[model samples]
Target: MQAILEEYLPNVMEIPDEFIEATQETIYMTVYTSLIAGVLGLFFGILLVVTRPGGILEQRVFFNILDQIVNIVRSIPFIILLALLVTVTRFIVGTSIGATAALVPLIVGVVPFYARQVEVALLEVDPGVVEAAEAMGTSPIGIIFRVYLLEGLPGIIRVSALSIINVISLTAMAGAVGAGGLGNLAVTRGYNRFQTDVTWVALIIILIVVFISQAISNWLIKKVSH
Candidate 1:
């Protein structure tokens, strides 16, 4: 049985060290990008919601400017965004290639996307709750943190999960530009080298990572909703 298994699945069984490194890089980029994007997105999203007309702190000018910027950024495709930000990436990370360098573009590309998602989530919160808080003399900042964010926790978690998954997908595009990761390994070692098994392995690993992420996110959503 062992001999048959080895013969049939030799490449899959003997995964290379570089593949492990690629996996680590993928995880690193995804996690850090998610953290950075999440924070920035949350800030922008709060501003977007709270600065709209009839919001707790209405400011049309600011909201319009922010809205336009987010729309412009989100419109750019990820692959082009990665190339377009080469200089910015080098300036920030002091290099234009590798996993660390990929983080800059990853954060930039995903920030607007996540921000929009977060804005939608926050907007879904019950308006009455916000009004009640306001009637009780809750400060704008206090109401934002308490009523909007806290009440919208479940929706926020859902969008956050979706954003992270999108980030994971974007990392693949980043890998195309010498950002070493599973995507790079699959492209260079699998497709380029004709190692179909390696490609399958990389894809399977990606699926596993996404599945775990989604499962955890779903569990948290359930717990929070309850």
Candidate 2:
């Protein structure tokens, strides 16, 4: 095992840029999906916070409906969700064989996950801030966007970072379909061919991604919170 790793490490380290086109694809897809998902997540998060019982808007009906929707979507397994949205993916992305093809599922998967995260984060904020906002005659939308969200910004960043990390993982699995990414590389060249070295390389790359995301997220939270 030692000799094998020693021999393969150099070659693995020397993979040409061409071999990593799909890796870049994963990054691009993840970023685009994160942007779309992040916005949708924030919207729903604020909606959840504001429309809950005794919240700024306090519409139980609206809150229940949104809650059920989030619960149902969240319950669906991600792999199944990916398979279920095949048509939508092709329609929007034009081809179901590349990173673009993966965007639809990525967004669908990330949005609900991040929305819940955002809701959880915002719900942790002190209730007095919301009450003060209402007492000041702040609009429902204004209070949600300005007060709850701003106060919970650090938690939001933490959740956003977590969502991005999960998105990266899901993107890797997408390689099982025609969606290309580091996962495809691991599947095709690493696992199938018994090249464990390639598998380790891909895994390391993913870990790097997680670490970078965490670091950047922490930095953002500190900067914004202060």
Candidate 3:
């Protein structure tokens, strides 16, 4: 067994340290991007709901402008958006070719997407519940927090999970542009160097990260629902 093990060790593919670092970068980008995007998305979503026609704080002007902004931003493909935001990214992060620089575009690209999801989630809340809250003389702010958000918590969790998954994909694309992550490793070491083993390893690691994220999201949904 020792003789066979020694023979196999030489044939085994060694994982590179950069690949490991890239994986960590991907995780970091996803986490911080999701957190910032989630908060901003939630705020914008609430504004969209409250400023709509016949809504609690109806304002045609505000709603039209905000709605148009979201639609316009969401229409741009993420890759193009990333390129378009290069100047912004450089200004914010002092560079546009690393995980930190990648984060700027990641958060910006996901914000409108997540905002639409949040709007849909909040809209799913029963109007009757909102009316009841108003009947109790609950302030608009109170209803937004206590009724809309609380009742929509389950839906919010689901959408948030979806957004996180989307961000993971985005990070992979960001990696293609020299954003240090699994995607970059796959491109540079795996594809460029003809290292199929490295490619497969990176793919597997990405899948594992995605699976864990989904599992945690599902658990949170169940826990909060109960």
Candidate 4:
């Protein structure tokens, strides 16, 4: 195994530890950001659904404001968003470089995307189901939890899976800002150094992560789907 790796990736063999550390950083960023963003996205998504016109808890003004916020945030490019959020990231994390610091921008960048995914997922829930819940005197919150959430579980899982994949790519881009992940490894140690093997190795690892995330999402969606 060692001989094969040395033959194929001589540069990576020279800095196996760097590769390992980069992989760990990527995983840490992806997991924490996904979790944090997932919760916030879900909340905002449900809000969008509930406040839209003719919704159970409709408030056109509140809905418009929130909808605009999500849309505006989503419209900003990720790299530009990173620059824009530099001060906020520093205040929140007490620094602006490293895996932890990357979390702020990652969460901010992806929340709107994921929230929109959540909105799309929830919107798929049957209107008749919602009406039935309302007719049965269920509270808006109850309908949200039981009807919208429960009914949309499969689609939510699908979108969440896609969001995790998106987060993985974002973590790679975060490397451009000193977040120290596979993106850093590939760019700083591999591409910058002209180590084609190292770059290929990094790409392979990222693809593996994406595949695993996709597989898990598929399994969960299948399990939850009616």
lDDT per model vs. reference: 0.90, 0.84, 0.89, 0.94
| Candidates 2 and 4 compared by lDDT, better number | 4
Off by over 4 Å in 3: 1-12
lDDT of 3: 0.89
Candidate 3 lowest-lDDT run of ten: 5-14
Instruction: Quote each prediction's TM-score.
Output: 0.96, 0.92, 0.93, 0.98
> Best by TM-score, which number?
4
lDDT of 4 by residue, 75-188 (tens): 999999999999999999999999999999999999999999999999999999999999999999899999999999998999999899999999999996699899988999
Give candidate 2's TM-score: 0.92
- Ordered by lDDT, highest first, the candidates read 4, 1, 3, 2
| Per-residue lDDT value at 123 in model 2 | 91
* Pick by lDDT: 1 or 3, better one: 1
Instruction: Show how many residue pairs clash in every candidate, following the order shown.
Output: 0, 0, 0, 0
Please write out the lDDT profile of model 1 over residues 1-226, one tens digit for every residue.
8798578657756767877899999999999999998999999999999999999889999999999999999999989998899999999989999999999989988999998998999999989999999999999989988999999999999999999889888887788769999999888878887888888888888888899999999999999988
3 or 4: which has the higher TM-score? 4
What TM-score does structure 1 among the candidates reach?
A: 0.96
Q: Which ten residues in a row have the lowest lDDT in candidate 2?
A: 10-19
Lowest summed lDDT window (length 10), candidate 1: 5-14
Cα lDDT of model 2 by residue, 1-226, tens digit? 8677568675465564735786698788778988999999889988888889887778999999999998899888888988899888878878777888888888888888889999999999998988888899988878877888789989999999999998998899887676887888888877888778778888888788779888999999889987
Give the best candidate by lDDT: 4
Model 4 stretches astray by more than 4 angstroms? none
